[model samples]
Target: MGRILDQPYDVNLQVTAVLSKLSLLPHPHLHEYLLDPYISLAPGCRSLFSVIVRVVGDLMLRIHRIPEFTPKLLLVRKRLLGLEPEGINIDHVTLLEGVIVLEEFCKELAAIAFVKYHAAASSSP
Candidate 1:
């Protein structure tokens, strides 16, 4: 197969389009199918895959505000970036924990938005 950078934009666009609204669906039976390829790519492609995942995650977060999906999305991030057990280094553990904390932060923001937007709107006359 060709390298990720060879067609980064197209791949990013396609993956983003397919996955952006995935959080709205039930948990997929096979998760991150599109991402499997990136994990096995050369190290140089990792950064490009990271960007692709970030874009997809951002789109999901912004559009859905489903706090439950945060961790799953980050897991995909960790996997695609080789931060999972098979590829993980001791030094990367802290990085993984930092990301989990960031996911918690995003969930808190979503909760805040629900209270400020949905709850407030519903309470109004």
Candidate 2:
């Protein structure tokens, strides 16, 4: 999301590109937007629901490299995988929660990354 690269934080094209890909995918599952973008919109069509959860889970695990980000990321991945507090009984509702977690992490990471970027820039020149 743009949150990761916005002001106060140095914009990293590579990071922004990754987050952008993630932002588009979670919308429909999270809401019934004007464009009607729900990935799991097809009722009883479990496949769409499955795919979104898997992809979002995978992306979250892969993108977070910072040491501070690891703990929460792992917990989210576990929940996505249905490893803790229960198993993966993913439905539209659960997927919504998952995306919310992902979005929250994105915001958190953006803030941390931005602060580091600002610090680095200030020292650069």
TM-scores for all candidates?
A: 0.29, 0.29
Q: Can you write out model 2's per-residue Cα lDDT over 13-90, one digit (the tens) per residue?
A: 354445445434435432222112244345644432354455666656644533444454455557656787754343
TM-score of 2: 0.29
Best by lDDT: 2
Off by over 4 Å in 2: 1-91
Error (Å) of candidate 1 at residue 15 is: 33
lDDT per residue, candidate 1, 1-125, as tens digits? 11222334345345434443442233432223322223455555443236545644654444354344556556646665678654433323333343444444345434444544565479899
Models, CA RMSD each: 16.9, 16.5
lDDT of each: 0.42, 0.44
